[model samples]
Target: MRKIIFICMVAATLFACKSASSTASTSTEATTLSTKLDRPTQVAIKGNWVLTNVTYPGSDYIKVNSFDLADSKCFIGSSWNFISNNNKGTMTLNSASCTAFTSPIVWSINNQGLFVLKIVNPGTKSKNVKEGYLLKVAGLTDTSFQLIDNINVGGQVKDVTYQFQRAN
Candidate 1:
């Protein structure tokens, strides 16, 4: 019937419009995220970065007391320094739970252009058995920087964003 044909046409047209709108919105979001980073380069990421905040939802990491972010006191004096010439870095933890935790790390941008932080030597003898993660540069400026990393939890991957401020 003509009525059925008309209804089908309307439905298809509506679906098309929605798809176009969603595509446009996604493009806008990508642009926004790119702009926020200032497109941080190797030189831009060099220097001292003091941990400012850590956030993860429904994570047992918070309950462990070791990685708690509720008060941010655990990372109050933590610092990460990225060296300019060699792509090497260091992490210093000053909190009581993680005091004297300093380790050498290496960093580089992966093929996908995401930052990758790696521990130079995760020796079995060390008490601090922390590893590194690949980070997405969220935002970068002269005095501030932000990064996000994804971790798998119970088969579901979750994103954890860490914010930092320039120390020097």
Candidate 2:
């Protein structure tokens, strides 16, 4: 009886140690995963990219002239221009010029490779005027990166992919 009890105790102790070791390892893995996701991978997305697909309400696929990202400024032709200088974000729509639409856009990246842009007006304190998402393509290149925006309209989200090539 004493020997049986001793064996049982030893087995219980072994199980407890194993459980503790596994819990510690799992905690370490969780920390590592969070750190990896938080760190943004800097990709050079500066260049001229043709808008192969742009989906708006009541519009299927609209062809945009060209989009440019320079000095933290995202310019869509001469009509729409967004400047993110010094982390100060501002967007302007040149309806009279060429790029016309909106301004004061806020940009952020989520873990799921989704680039989000929230457009807000300057004077009006209203909700987000326009919101969009861009999905990252698999093969990331030095000059060009492919992106798809599907959930723009209510219809089926089509893969409007664009390959942005570096200009300067």
Candidate 3:
């Protein structure tokens, strides 16, 4: 009876230690594993890119304030730098006809293939910013990709596609 009790206690201790070790590693590694964006996807997307165009249904009539930064048309020809290694980058408005500015952004591709982005206002940390935008990634390729944002147009949801090209 004594030997059985001792064995049971040792087994329990072993499980407890194993659970603790696993929990420690998971907490630290969770961020990377949180998304299903594989290494290849990350590699393909990490680089300098340009916003070639922003188009949507009825775009010829309605206007959109993209990211609350500027008119959707103004985002065309913008310079964007995406560094997937650190999930951070910058977007610069280069359109001469619109407000010229640049902003820091933190981003990630979530498991659902949503491009989750938080535009960090001037001097704030990404975590403190409670608002973000989610865009579906489509037609990703070595030379190009598209971010499709669902928007409300005339009380109905419509797709707004932002096309990107790999910068030279």
The residue-level lDDT of candidate 3 at 71 comes to 93
Best candidate (score: lDDT): 3
Query: Candidate 1: which stretches are off by over 4 Å?
Result: 1-40, 59-73, 122-132
Q: Give candidates' CA RMSD values in order.
A: 14.9, 13.9, 8.3
In order, the Cα lDDT scores of the candidates are: 0.59, 0.37, 0.78
Question: What ordering of candidates by TM-score runs from best to worst?
Answer: 3, 1, 2
Query: Candidate 2, clashing residue pairs?
Result: 78-99, 79-98, 79-99, 79-100, 80-99, 91-103, 91-104
Index of the highest-TM-score prediction: 3
Better of 2 and 3 by lDDT: 3
Candidate 1 lDDT, 1-168, residue by residue in tens = 999999999998988652221110110121111211123476788889998877766654543132222334465568889885776888777777744567776665543456655555556422233344456776778888777655555776666667889996
lDDT of 1 at 116: 56
Candidate 3, 53-139: lDDT as tens digits: 999988888988887778999999999988898889999999999989898987777655767677889879866765667777899
Using TM-score as the yardstick, the better of models 1 and 3 is 3
